[model samples]
Target: MTVRVDQFPEVQGVVSEPPVQARNLSVGEVLGQVTELVQAKKYDEVQALLQNAMGQHPNNGDLINANGYVLTAMKRQSDALRWYRDALEFSPMGSGIWNNLGTAFKHLKFYNVAIACHQRAIALSNNEAFLHHNLGLCYAEVGQHGEAIMAFDRALALQSDFHLARWDRARSYLHLGNYRKGWADYEVRLVSGQIPARSVSGRQWTGTPYAGSRLLVLAEQGFGDTLWALRYLPRVKGLGGELIVECQPALCSLVASLGVADRVVAKGEPLPEADYYCSFCSLPGLFTPDLSLLPAQPYLSKPAEREAKFEPYLRKGAGCLKVGIVWSGSVTFERNAERAISLERLLQSVDFPGVQLYSLQKGSPEQELQGVELRRPIIDLAPELKDFADTAAVVANLDLVIMTDSAVAHLAGGLGVPVWILLGHSAHWLWLLDRADSPWYPSARLFRPRIEGDWDHVLDNLAIELMKLATVKVPLSSVG
Candidate 1:
C-alpha cells in the first residue's frame, strides 16, 4: 500500500525572527511565530493566532498561507484549500503556498489537483527537493509507480539525504515487484523515523551466524504485518540461535503456538536476556531478498482444544458450504476506508447457493450490518471472538473465508485455510500486482477491482467464483 506523505509532520528548521519594529510586527515575523506554534504542536493556538493576525492584515499572503497550514494540520483539508486559494489570490507566484496547497489536496485524495499544484510549485522553484517528493507521493497514490519512482529519483538527486523520499520510493519499487531494490531501500524506514529503532542492549542482527546465541525478534508495525512476518521465524531459528519474540498482547498466544520462537513476550513486558535482536519484518530482507525462498506452508494452526470450543458454530445443513466473511479491518488503520467495504454492499452483490456466511468482521465497521437486509442469514461470531486465536479457532471450522484486506485474511492464509481476498486496484505491496496467486499464501486467491474504487466489479467477479466454489464437495474431515 502507498503510505500517505501528508501523514508525516513537516520538518521545520530553526529560523531567527527579524527584529520587531516600533509598531506591529511584519507578516513574516507573525508567520514565524505561527511556525513555532506549529512545530510545538499547539495547533489550536496556531489557528487562533492566525485568525487574529489574518484579521489585522487581511491582504497578507504569508498570513493567509500560514492559516491554511494550520487548517491542514488540524485535518480540515477542505477549509485549508479555501485559505490556500485566498493566499494564491494575494501572491500567485509564491512556490511555498502552492506546495502547501498540494499537500492539503493530497490529504483529501484529490490526486490530480495535488499533482497540478505540485507541478505549479516546481514551475516556480524547480530545484526544491520537497516539491518533487510531494509530486512523487501523488503519483504513487494514483498507481503511477514509474512516474513516482522517477519523481523520487529527482528528489534524491537534489537532496541525497531525503530519507522520506527514499522510503516512499521503496514502497513503489516493492509495489512493482522489484524486491531487491525495495527491501534494500526499506532500511530507510528506520532512518526516515517511520519505524523507530528498538533500544535493546544487543547489536542488531545482520544475517550473520548466531550459533548457540540467543536472538530476540522484535515485532514491528501492525498485527497483520507481524503475522505475515512470523513465517520467517523458523528461518531465524535455523540461523542457529534460540529465538524470543516480542509482540503485541493480542498476538502473544497466537505467535507462541507457532513453535519457532523459544519464548514469546508481549510488548511492554520485561524482556528475556538475548545476545542479538532484529525487527520481525527485517528478516525477509535478510533471508529472502529474492522473494523466491518463501515457505508457502501453514505455519500457524488452531489448537485442537481451541478448535473444539468453536465446533458448535460450524453446524450447517447437509452438503452446505460454511464460509467466514470479514468486510472490514480496524478503523484506525490509515487505509481502512479503502480496504473495507460495507457489509450491505457485499451482501447485495453476492449470492452463494447452499452456503452459510458467518460474519468475521470486528470493530466499528461491524455496525454496517445493523438493520441491513440479507438474502441469506449471516451468523455474527465477532462478539464470541476474544482474540486472534479465537478468530483462528472459529476459522478452523469454516470451509472457506472471503475477506477484504485485514488481519483475518493473513490469519486464514497462515493457517492454510482456503481464503479469497478482495482487493482494490492498488492493493498491498505484499500481494504484488497483476497476479491472482500469492507466494506468501499458497491457498489464498486474489480478487481485485477492475477499476479503482469499483467494488461492484470486484463483487460481481467474486459472485461467479463463489458459485464455482460452492459446486465443489468439501470432505467432512476438512470441516470441524
Candidate 2:
C-alpha cells in the first residue's frame, strides 16, 4: 500500500547566507537565519531560533518549511508532512515548500502521490534535477521502467555528473534485462575510487599481476551470490593468471575442489601471497562480454560417496514422495526477515497426504516436526554437515527440494538438482515478472508472488502444486 505526502523538487539552490545578520533585520530575515542553520545541518539550535523568529511573525511559510525539514531529518516523517502542508496552506506558490512535501511522501512509500507532487513542483520550477530523480524512483517502484529511464535522463541532462541518477538508471535498466546499460552503469563500483575503508593493509592487492603471480579472489557478499558468481573464476584463471581464492570458512574446501583456482583459504585465516585481487562479483565484466555469454556451467560438488551417505538418511516410510524443505536464509541480510517464511506457515501450506518432509535448512536450532513415521526428532542436519558438499549429498537423495532464495537454492541448482524456488513479491531482477523458469538456473522453477509484496497467496498456490506432485502416479522403478 502506498502512502500519500508532498513531493520535493530538485532545485538549483541559492547559496545559504550566514545565520547572524549584521543589518537591521525584519522577522522574515531572522527566519532565514534559522533556515541557514537547517541547511548547514545545525539542527539543535534550529528550534530555539525558529521559536524566537515565530514570536515576531507567527505564521511564516519559509519557517514552516524549514521546521518540516528538521522533523524529516529526525525521521518524524508523518509529522514533517503536516508541517509541509501548513507551509503550503500559507503560501501555495512556494515551489520549495511543495518540493519538501513531495520528498516526505516519497519517504513514506506513497509512490503515486509522490509522483504528482514532484510533477507539481516541476511545474512551479522547471529546471530541478532532484525532482526528476525523485519522480523516476517512484516510477521505477511501480514498474514504469520506460518513464523512469526518461526521468533519469532529464536529471542527467540538467546535471551531467549526477552519480545517484546514474546508479538508479543502471538498476532500472538491469531490472528490464538491458544488460549492456546495466553492466556499464555497474562499472562505477570499481571506478568510483572508493572501496570500503576496511583495514586492507596486509590483505588488499591491486590488479597488477606479473609472471607467476598468484591472484586472490575474495568472496565479499552473501552465500548465494558468492556461490553463483564463483562460476566465472575459471575464466579469470584462463587469462594467464595464477589464483588463490578466499571464501567463507564453511565454503573453503567445497570451493577448492572446483578446479578453477590453485588454493582456497577460509575467512580470517589469511595470506597465501597473491599479487592481485578482485571481488567475486567483479569477475563478470572481465570474463563475459555480455549477459548472453554467461557460461551457465555447473561448477559444484558431487561426492563419490553421495549415494552411500544419503541412503542411511532416508528410510522406507509410507509416504509416496520424500520432499526436502528450506524455509529461511541468512537473518543478517537486509530483506531476510521479509523473505523468510515461518516454519509453521510452510508446513501448513504443503499437503502431506503421501509425502515425508525433511528439513535441509542451515543455521542454528534446525526444524521441528510432529506427526510423521520414522521420526527420530527433526534432525538439525546443519551443524553436523560441512559446507555445500554435505548439503549436496542430502539434496541428491531427496525427490525434490522446495526452498526460498538462499545459498541452498544456489547449491541445488549448481548440482543440477531440480527445485521449486519460492520467491517474494518484487523480487531481485533475476526472477523478473510472472515466469516459471530462469535463464540463470535451467534446473529450477520459479514460484513468484501473484501481487506485489504478497506471500500468503503465492505460498497457497505452491501448496496446491506440491500436493499434485506428491500424488502423481509413477512406476516403482522410476522412484529410484
Of the candidates shown, which would achieve the greatest lDDT relative to the real structure?
Answer: 1
Model 2: worst 10 consecutive residues (lDDT sum): 1-10
Indicate the TM-score of model 2: 0.76
TM-score, cand. 1: 0.89
Deviation in angstroms for 23 in model 2? 21
For all predicted structures, in order, the TM-scores are: 0.89, 0.76
Which regions of candidate 1 fall more than 4 Å away from where they truly are? 1-23, 39-45, 369-376, 471-480
- Tens-digit lDDT track for model 2 on 298-381? 666566454565565576433557777898887777678667887767777764666767788766415343333342234435
Clashing residue pairs in candidate 2, if any? 6-101, 6-102, 7-101, 7-102, 8-99, 8-102, 8-103, 9-99, 10-131
lDDT of 1 by residue, 1-480 (tens): 001233443311113344333336556666666655765688887677667777789998877877777777677889988988998998899887888888888887788998999989889874778789889988988889899999999999999998988998999998888888899889888767788756786888998989989999987889999989888887778889688999999898888777778889999898877789888888888877676777758888885657775666676424678888888888998788898888877876444667788888888877776776665667788888878888888887788999899888889999999999999866888988789988889989999887678888889888887887675566899999
Error of 2 at 181 (Å): 1.7
